[model samples]
Target: MSGKAGTETMFRFTCPACEMSPIVDAVIRADMLANGCYLCGTQVSESAFREVCEE
Candidate 1:
């Protein structure tokens, strides 16, 4: 993917504390989402957000 198409590959990181999801400007690898929070210093992953969204 390139140009506009590459933009779609970007993912947003949501803060677990404030529930503020920010669209990260940089590209995030699939594995990186399994770690900790980049915003509110919480330990979270993509699955965590999915769980929150489900509730």
Candidate 2:
């Protein structure tokens, strides 16, 4: 998927609680990534994994 220049494509994952999708701020440089939920601290998308490791 293509996004606006300078702004990276953000993927929203379902939140464990409330089930509301949230966009991740972490940049996705790799094909696969994973991260925890920013709101409920639940496991998020794999794309965020790279960001979590970078931090």
Candidate 3:
């Protein structure tokens, strides 16, 4: 994780709340730790979103 308070990377994944719909604006650490949804500002599932990152 970036040590700074306001640093992030853009992650695209499926929305877990909306029936796995593809989402294109999640933010995790550069190391793939869970952050928040850049679209809706929700930090729901970091690990699940991280799994889809390799795609």
Estimate every model's Cα lDDT from 0 to 1: 0.50, 0.46, 0.45
Steric clashes per prediction: 0, 6, 0
Clashing pairs in model 2?
33-46, 33-47, 33-49, 34-46, 34-48, 34-49
Residues 1-47 of candidate 2 have per-residue lDDT tens digits of 65446755555555555576545453532222343555555555563
Q: Please give the range of 10 consecutive residues that has the lowest summed lDDT in model 2.
A: 46-55
Tens digit of per-residue lDDT, candidate 3, span 1-55: 5466643444556555444445344333332235544445455565545433332
Compose the digit string of candidate 1's lDDT tens values, residues 1-55: 3435333444556666768775553334243355555555566666543222211
Top candidate (TM-score): 1
Error of 2 at 46 (Å): 2.4
Better of 1 and 3 by lDDT: 1
- Which whole-number lDDT from 0 to 100 does residue 23 have in model 2? 51
- The reply for model 1, stretches above 4 Å from the true place, is 1-8, 25-35, 48-55
